[model samples]
Target: MDNLRKELLRPSAESKQEVSGKVVSYFAILLIGGLVGTILIFLTVKGIALFTGNHFSLREFLTGVNWQPGHHHFGALPMITTSFSVTVFSGLVALPLALVVAIAITEMLPSRVYKFFQPVIELLVGIPSVVYGYLGLTVIVPQLRQMFGGTGFGILAATCVLFLMILPTMTSMTIDSLRAVPQSYRQASTGLGATRWQTISRVILPSAKSGILTAMVFGMARAFGEALAVQMVIGNTTVMPKGVMESAATLTSVLTTGIGNTVMGTAANNALWSLALILLIMSLAFNLLIRLVSRKGVR
Candidate 1:
């Protein structure tokens, strides 16, 4: 009897130990993944620094306007300006339209309308980025050419293309967020003598505010990273574009097409690498800001 009791207890103890080992294994996997990611990021930055031997001077980066790589000039004012301008204008064009559509679909419209529109929305999402770029080049550039000095390629076209690209993301996010707003909150706002517009502008939007911001940020990031479409439409003019009509090149376009296009050992290659680093930093900062905002609450 004693031997049988001991055998039973031994299996129970071994089972518990096995479960504990699995739990620890899961945590160890998480730890290892995080460490690998951190190490890779650190090494990338360190490698760039070591390879260039260029001091990471923020002042030089921010204030410089001449960004030619052949002569060791790394000014990026034009690229920064164009990227931000295109993104901001695109977001502006997309956001209100997205919000209104989301409201119409999620708030006033019947379930039937949402069902009908969901397919279209998903269809828009399925279209590739290259197609959008091609459309901008073929369709938009021709439209611009007729009226705008026959260049057909400029920031204006890029902005319009970006607007179309950004709309789907903004609308999808907005619809999801707006739909998630508690019905009770809407009803309570209505009960408190608030008009529909007042209720929507105040209670409902505030509830979905974080999601809306996320949508905008995501749109901006998407616009920033968009190389093909904007590259196709924007004239690739190295000089800052004079108004929306002129051609302009972006960091991505510059990096891929500049002197680095051929043999290495040249100034353009170094400059292309530097431009890439700058762009990477910008991308990283935007992602970091999103995380910080998410954790600390957007102020």
Candidate 2:
């Protein structure tokens, strides 16, 4: 009787063990998706890069300073300049405004007012960039064209459009960061006779430094990599940006223009891939810096 009961219980226990093991295996597979995706994408892009005369000699590409791919003189500086100028300009325009707006929303406003404004800010995030470009095309581009006297679509117009496009993202991220800090810090400062402004400026801002940097750097990457809205507003000039009002071409724009026009195995294709590789590296560096800063901030 004892042997019969033990044998009957053994199979049931084994069945339960098998089912549990299968469920655990299913979860383990799902959790590794990020690593698998990154590996796959890296392999794909690298393979494409290798086929396009991938070499270490980017001297002509980076230092030659001309970038007329039709004539085979592919200096990337002009495109880089356009990219740098627009991103820097966008950062300058958005940083202070986003910071102020985020601070107002998170710390200064009454809860009722912040609640009212929150939906509008969130809605702005989902608005299509093309719609923003269309508005720039109709309103900002024409206004700038009249004031600056050229194709209304220029670096100035691109910067303004990108600035508006990136604003909500930056502010939302900054607000999250501000809210992450402990309330006790604020209360302690208040108890010590600090004004609300002083408490925020002295105790809160410094403590939230890494969060703030993360937001701006993310905005920088978005502004730098933006293509469609930028191409619509930017006049597609290859020359260096002469002024903020001047037209310029960026790395993303170059990639866009070359996609259908350039041959697959040619130097032009290689150049575009090289430019893409550089952009990827730049974005990676920005993210790493954010991580480093955030690590240091964890006091």
- State residue 237's C-alpha deviation in candidate 2, in Å: 1.2
Model 1 clashing residue pairs (backbone): none
- Taking the candidates one at a time, how many backbone clashes does each contain? 0, 0
Off by over 4 Å in 1: 1-62, 264-266, 296-299
lDDT of 2 by residue, 133-162 (tens): 787888899999888797877789989999
| TM-score, prediction 1 | 0.83
lDDT score, candidate 2, position 26: 89
Residue-level lDDT of model 1, residues 1-299, one tens digit each, is 99988877776767889999999999999999999789657546543651456653556655677766556666677887888788888888888899899988987889999999988987886688889989999899998898776688888999989888888888898899888888999999999999988988999988888777777787778888787788889988777767888888877666556743645545445556556766777788778866765555345
* CA lDDT of each prediction against the hidden true structure: 0.78, 0.82
Give candidate 1's total backbone clashes: 0
Model 1 has an lDDT value of 0.78
Candidate with top TM-score is 2
